[model samples]
Target: MAKKDYYKILNLSRDASQTDVKKSYRRFARKYHPDVNPGDDIAVQRFKEVKEAYEVLSNPHLRDQYDTYGRTDLDSGDVSHGTTYGGADSVEVNNDVFETDVDSDIYEVSTGEDPYSQPGGGPEPGSDLSFELTINFENAVYGAEREINVPTFRICEACSGSGSAPGTKTAECKTCQGTGQVFERDRYSGEMSLVQCKACYGRGKIIQTPCMRCNGNGSFQTYEKILIKIPPGVDNGSRLRIHGKGTPGVRGGPPGDLYIVIKIKDHEIFERHGNEILCEAFITFPQAVFGTEIEVPTLDGTAKMKIPPETQPGTIFRLRGKGIVDMHTGARGDQHVKISIVVPKNLSERQRGLLYKYARTTGEL
Candidate 1:
């Protein structure tokens, strides 16, 4: 049998610093932790090897003895040149090993003091909530107030969020003896580690009687009506944030935020391009040939615009300060009107005669 190299196991050199050793250990531990790779035999073996390597390299005295004699075992009394090293003593792991909660991205480490063992437990912030809302195109351009119903979880009022009936008290968890943690020995590695207590879920205390209304859950689902103000010039895919409007927190922690994703409806008469407005207006052939005044739709109301003589079809005219207002700069944009010529389908006998005489004069008859 041969001894494994501690430095090689951690992917470090013998001259690596203590900080570097600890950093590599945390990275490997997170990758091979039992909770992260459940039921994987290969990962479990790698985790045990990483732990053993860290235990020897983290201690200064053990590292010096290994460097000199190439072995850390002192119980055999095989000393070179009558040198004496420290006898076998239990090694205390100062650096913490972490267990991750994938859903919440929370890390539970072996820190001596358990947060849930405190008087009122710990304050955990609520999770943020998001919702999508659709608004009218006019409302998005000019802005308006909208009321929406959001269904979410709220703290129960029956037992005041305690999860217990009135006058009933909570008792200490016997499984962990109120310490919120328990020591367990690994069957394969024969190493002991502290893990969160499953009985009380690391809460040190357990409710004696469950709440009748909430069924022992601290919160209940309900619909909340909230009035939100939409800012002007908001386009589709705009997001609005409301503070402290999400789910209720635990143990007096702050509530999360509420997010509203905006979706704008299509308009029949007008189209928006950034802060600018675009619209098409139909004009008679005579009106386009000779100058005339026409009415066009705008954000405020209808506005009159003048067309010049000899104007061609598809000519564009601009009306200043008739478009949407800029939300941030407070500046207004221009409205563009595209001209389209309309030809009469039916012509009277007298009108046809006059048109034939005009065509003869122009040498087109």
Candidate 2:
């Protein structure tokens, strides 16, 4: 049978969002489920078809693979193509603009037929995987280039993730009986979680001969080298999105994303309070009294500052454009130099005598 566009089956676009895929599936199911349609075979088939489409494209990884490979094997419950590995084919989104991330555990299980295809069940995508990444403090701050290793259940290239060793047809799931979703009716139990048939792991087909590399799971856990670019000036708890980098979705669904969460390390000498930076500098009594020239530390390097005569301890001197850079506006904040006067621990007799003389002259002897 010629392949059907699973997107149209679910009444969703090929580029529909995850939410849209889910909503479309729910609507399709409501209209076609056997319980709802009451023995309508056409509606039953449509329900299975829409469900298959939702299973794949909703996942980012699966969708990317499907988009790239354009394989119609999913309709026959064939996972014949293993993942074509590469990191440059990744997706990236700017967080400063969107500023949001989502964490979810997605499962893509195919059963019975080509759930998303033009055939009996429809078309479907591939499986999805999930994992977590931890970034460094400085990397989180300046954004960095890094390579990481991850695990995924990619399709089996040998037998094509088909779980079949070679050119063998997989059997339809007996529990769900290729329907993918098993219906349960209990007198007391009002609603149920619509358990995916465990026999096929919710995929309507069973592998006759499993692939050696993936052990019939259709994928392996070998880590791939992935290099990522972190953006500049991302604050702590910020998230960087790498598209098409998540686990492979079903035969045709979209893949998930790699969410890089920024964990900025606190600076030892400087403390950041919003847009401003605060630090303490010790000044001698003469510098405070006579208003002398002092070198102050700022983001742009060292600058000569005029200490006003009679400047007391704890005096704050603002240095324009010297603090932390603003991520949004690109404007800089002023560095607040808080002066602290330190008294010398040891005093010479000559200095003491001079101080006594000056004190007497000042009428404070």
Candidate 3:
């Protein structure tokens, strides 16, 4: 069977940006979601297809593989006729066994079939998983480790993923006589083709007794606790990749990856913009008039900042290299302090007199 064009499925062009892909996927997903179109098999199938397309296109590695090889199964040996081992002439050698030498390796060729073509049983890559993690502001700035529980699927432990009960055996499929295939004739063209047997689903065997734990499904769902390392300088919307920590593979295929989307909690005193930190400090009128030092809060505790003489209200001071560290470049950012002048609401008579005298001397009263 021909592979579906993912771009078409998403109603996008091949050059569509990642943002475009995401937008289209969300639109299609909402329209065809199972809850929205309950009892509609066609809508359910469309939703599944859209989800599959999004999964492949949203990943850079998988998207690149799909673009280059026209498929995302990176480990599969199947290729186009021109790229096959025996070249164009090898297309007709489906049932013929031939030896080919490439890079000092000899491979025996057989009928061209997808490694995962069998629906009943075959090695299939696991689906990638995503989760959102919210960390403290300090943790986002300086790195921390956390433990989280993720619910996912795993191979059944009772029957060791065999789908058979303990001390039980399987029987050959009677539909195809253990061949796992049956001949089907096309109604219009009257052409015959060998297709997978529906009874055994191409596994050629049936479990006489199903495993009580997994119900002969070969896998089960459970919650797994995992320890994750969060790097420094992770801001809101930051993504971290954890390899082989997603859903377990099927039939011994490789497991998918886990993606953690980071959300930084808002700080009580500090506000972040990119790598820079913004904070406010209030000073008395005298302190702003005559230079004075004040303590300012920082990630490493309070630090002293000098208030220059005649500093205007809303004046900003920069403390170099006191902000967050860039995770990619390893460079530090600066912290900015905005100074605000405060006037005493309740003042002693002597203080008020001194202030009036100062204002008169400065010609401001």
Identify the leading candidate in terms of TM-score: 3
Worst 10 residues of 2 by lDDT: 102-111
Per-residue lDDT of candidate 2, residues 1-365 (tens digit): 35567777887644354555777788887888889888788988888877766665665444444442333344433334443311233323233332113112222221122233221133344322333344443343344555555444465677654556676677887777776667655558876545556577667777777776677766565666666555544455443445655555544554455444445556665566655777788888877888888887765558888888999999898887776555444566777888999987678999888877988999996
TM-score of each: 0.53, 0.54, 0.56
Cα shift from native, residue 74, model 1 (Å):
68
Off by over 4 Å in 1: 1-121, 157-212, 356-365
lDDT of each: 0.69, 0.57, 0.72
Clashes in each model (backbone N, CA, C under 3 Å)? 0, 40, 0
Q: Kindly provide the TM-score of model 3 when superposed on the true structure, using C-alpha atoms.
A: 0.56
Question: Which pairs of residues have clashing backbones in candidate 1?
Answer: none
- Give Cα distance to truth, residue 294, candidate 1, Å: 1.0
Candidate 3: tens digits of C-alpha lDDT, residues 282-365: 999889989899999987889999888999999999999999987545698999999999888989999899989989998998
After aligning candidate 1 to the native by TM-score, how far in Å is the CA of 39 from where it should be? 47
RMSD of 1: 22.4
> Which one wins by TM-score: 1 or 2?
2
**Quick one: best lDDT, which candidate?**
3
